[model samples]
Target: MIKWLEIDGQSSVAVARRFARTVATAAGFPEVRTEEAVIVVSELASNIVKYAGCGRMLVQWMPHARGYRLAIVASDKGPGIGDLALMMKDRQSSGGSAGIGLGAVKRLSDRFDIHSTPDGGTIVACEFLAPGLGLHPSIELAGLFLAHPDEDICGDRWQAWEMPHGLRLALVDGMGHGPQAAEAAGTIIDMLESHARLPPSEALGNVMRDYRNIRGGVASVADIDASRGEIGYANIGNIASMRLRPGEIKRFPTRNGFVGNRSAEPLAEAAAAGRGDYLIFHSDGLKAVGADMLLPLHGHNCLLMAAWLLENGEVLKDDVTIVIARVHGRRTHAENG
Candidate 1:
């Protein structure tokens, strides 16, 4: 599960620490690692409160390789740090405060990434992985699934996996919120998973044929072709899809129909996309404005970007799922599997 915290003071810092400890324990980290995670959380929260005055944090224990890891992302729209290299050293104070916070977080985390721009503020992402496992170096992807406020089962479902040519990601929101909707979502995902090797439009078309017996759901799929340097996107319903390239963000209009029932004709859009390009696909449970307002964060870690969007824009009335991914490094696509 993913949780978001609002941090502006010492008390919120304490809350963040507690959250870190809880997730660390739940993720089965050793005691020593848990304490280190607490320290990392405290330092991250303290720096945000002291430098930015107010910011947001996202925490969750997610699957990584064979084991799980705790992911913590802190974001704030304050004055961006200058000379981050100098600030990363011990005792390198910038705001008349102890200069060891960022350095300490980097030291304690198993993996870390930070991006701060004069215009985009700061985003710090860290992960504490379980012992005895290694991370895939070729590709990185992250997503979150949230059930409706009143229901135990989420009608929305999402998945990301690799193909021989590139990567395939999809999000499906079953017709409504409940058992029937959940079943429809399950059916659609099963169909998509079986057809993942096909193009986005063809995959959805497969679902359309087999999904007629079940309740229908909206679906959006994207195929990232590394060789072709293109992103092939197709949608069967109202799920929001965006292509964020350098200096520009493009939003695709919903195809305006369902997969099984009265669906629109299957058509896929292919656009040029190479390294550093990002794609975002989310269900309608999140407001459309959420993605627009967080455009400054496009340069941050994919997990952090996904969390920030959900934290601010969740409509709280339906199941919400958001997946964020970026294309980088020319590693072979099969390396990701």
Candidate 2:
């Protein structure tokens, strides 16, 4: 599960550390690794209190080739670091403490990245693998899921898997809110996972065929070719899909009709997605404002970006699910599997 904690003051640091330690333990991290994770959390939480004054952290468990990993994201809307190079140096402390926090975090993490803009904000993302686990290069995946206020289960679902072409992704929003809606959405998720080898259009068609007896929903699917810097996508109903680059935002149009009930064959389309581009897919539960606001957070950690959107932009009237993915390095044929 993805968990979020707010960091506003000194006390919040302890809370954040406790949350991180608990999650690490639950993920089966060894005592040594869990202690390291706690230290990372303490340092990041302290940084938020010392520098940003207020910020938030997101912690989640991610499946890896060898074992599981702990993914941590810390973000703050404070004055951004002016010289990241200097700050990362081993004894360089901007907060007057031993300058080893950020550096130590980088050394302890299996994967690390940071994005900051001078007045915009700072987001630091780190991943710690389980003891004795080997690490593999991977595409970053991050998203948020929220059930409708009146329903116990969310009708929206999303998933991603590596494919021979690159990566395959899908987002589905079941017709209504409640248990029945969740079942319809859940079935679509299962179909996507099982039939990931099929092309987006064909796979979507298969979903439509299998969803005959269930209440229909809107769906969008995409095939990302990181090597070619392109994305091929198709969709039906109101699911929104978009690509955000440095300054430009491009929106993909979805064909009208519900997936199972009444739907037209969605014509697949292709577009350019460069190294720093962001691909976002979400259910209609998000309003235009919420969707538009995500543009400024283009290069941040995918999970942090999704969490920010869910926390600030959600309408809360309906179930919401947002998936954010960023194209990084090319994956080899072996890694693609």
- Model 2 alpha-carbon miss at residue 219, Å: 2.1
Task: State, as a TM-score between 0 and 1, how close model 2 is to the true structure.
Answer: 0.77
Candidate 1 C-alpha RMSD relative to the actual structure: 4.9
lDDT of residue 207 for candidate 1: 80
Summarize candidate 2's per-residue lDDT along 1-337 as a digit string, tens digits.
3335789997988888888889888878889889888888888888888898998887766543245667787888888888899887765777788635687788987767777777667878788877776643435665666678777777877777776646777888988988888888878878867777788888887777666645877889998777766788988889889887766778888888877854467657888766667789888788754435766777676766766676567455888888877777553342222
Task: Compose the digit string of candidate 1's lDDT tens values, residues 1-337.
Answer: 3335789999999999998888788777889999998888888888888888999787776543245667788888889899999788765667878545677778888777787878767888887778775554444567766677778777877776666656787888999887788888878888888997788898888788767745789998888776656778888888888877655777866776788864466557877666667788888888775435666776677777776676556466788888877777474443222
Q: Which ten residues in a row have the lowest lDDT in candidate 1?
A: 328-337
**Model 2: worst 10 consecutive residues (lDDT sum):** 328-337
Taking every candidate in turn, the Cα RMSD to the unseen true structure, in Å, is 4.9, 4.7
- Each model's lDDT: 0.76, 0.75
The C-alpha local distance difference test score for the whole of candidate 2 amounts to: 0.75
